[model samples]
Target: MDLDSQALNMSSRADLVEFLGGLADSFATHPERWQNANLPDFLNAWAAWLEDMDGYFQNRGESVPTSASWQLIAQMLLAARVYE
Candidate 1:
């Protein structure tokens, strides 16, 4: 299998962090949808982490994008790379 042949552009690290932030806000307004949704382990873990970070940011009086956010973004990119 040619790795390059299957490679494609994905969201950038910054974009992913921003997206997570938006998702956090959305989750706050509609937690009911997630109660019964069957999400993959990876996705569920990511959502939990995002929720935690969102709360942390709010409590600490910090910025939106934190180190954990960047780290998670990199981790997702690396996981996707391995499947390629």
Candidate 2:
């Protein structure tokens, strides 16, 4: 299976996270099925962790961080890299 092709079909970050979570669950339930697993299965976990972090801040009356800022930062980093 082409992971990139499968990934391209995901319409949103939530979809991607759901797919990764299913994969992780499958591995956990049947380790033998993933004995040859090579690719890291951390993206979904990372997404969940970020969600928890956002929720923690929001529950404390802090504004939830928006991905817009991260997107802008990423764009600036990429622009700087190109100029370098």
Candidate 3:
């Protein structure tokens, strides 16, 4: 509702690309730090994390977004690393 609200932080298309590139760089630079080093396991973990993210928002007294946005997607991907 306000400028300070996280809702205002949506990334533009270019920003999203750059952000994802940064994630790629991070992963490339330090694959050893990741909990899921392979695709299948990471995908499974990512799906599980995204599924539970709504309840996490609810438990924190936040409203769960009915729709997904670029920011939410990025947050979920980041969380998937060790969310379980």
Q: Rate the local accuracy (lDDT) of all candidates.
A: 0.59, 0.64, 0.72
Evaluated at residue 5, the lDDT of candidate 3 is: 39
Off by over 4 Å in 3: 1-8, 69-84
Q: Candidate 1: what lDDT?
A: 0.59
Query: How many collisions per candidate?
Result: 0, 0, 0
TM-score (all chains, Cα) for each model: 0.32, 0.33, 0.62
- lDDT tens string, model 2, 25-70? 7777787765455434554555576668877777889887565466
Model 3 Cα lDDT, one tens digit per residue, 1-84: 222332346457665556656667768998997899888988889889888988979998999877666587678678978887
Residue 66 local lDDT, model 3: 74
- Candidate 1 lDDT tens digits, 1-84: 122222223246565456556556656777675653444755677778766877767787977664445676567767977774
Best by lDDT: 3
RMSD of every prediction: 15.2, 14.7, 9.2
What's model 2's lDDT at 70? 63
Best by TM-score: 3
lDDT of 3 at 70: 54
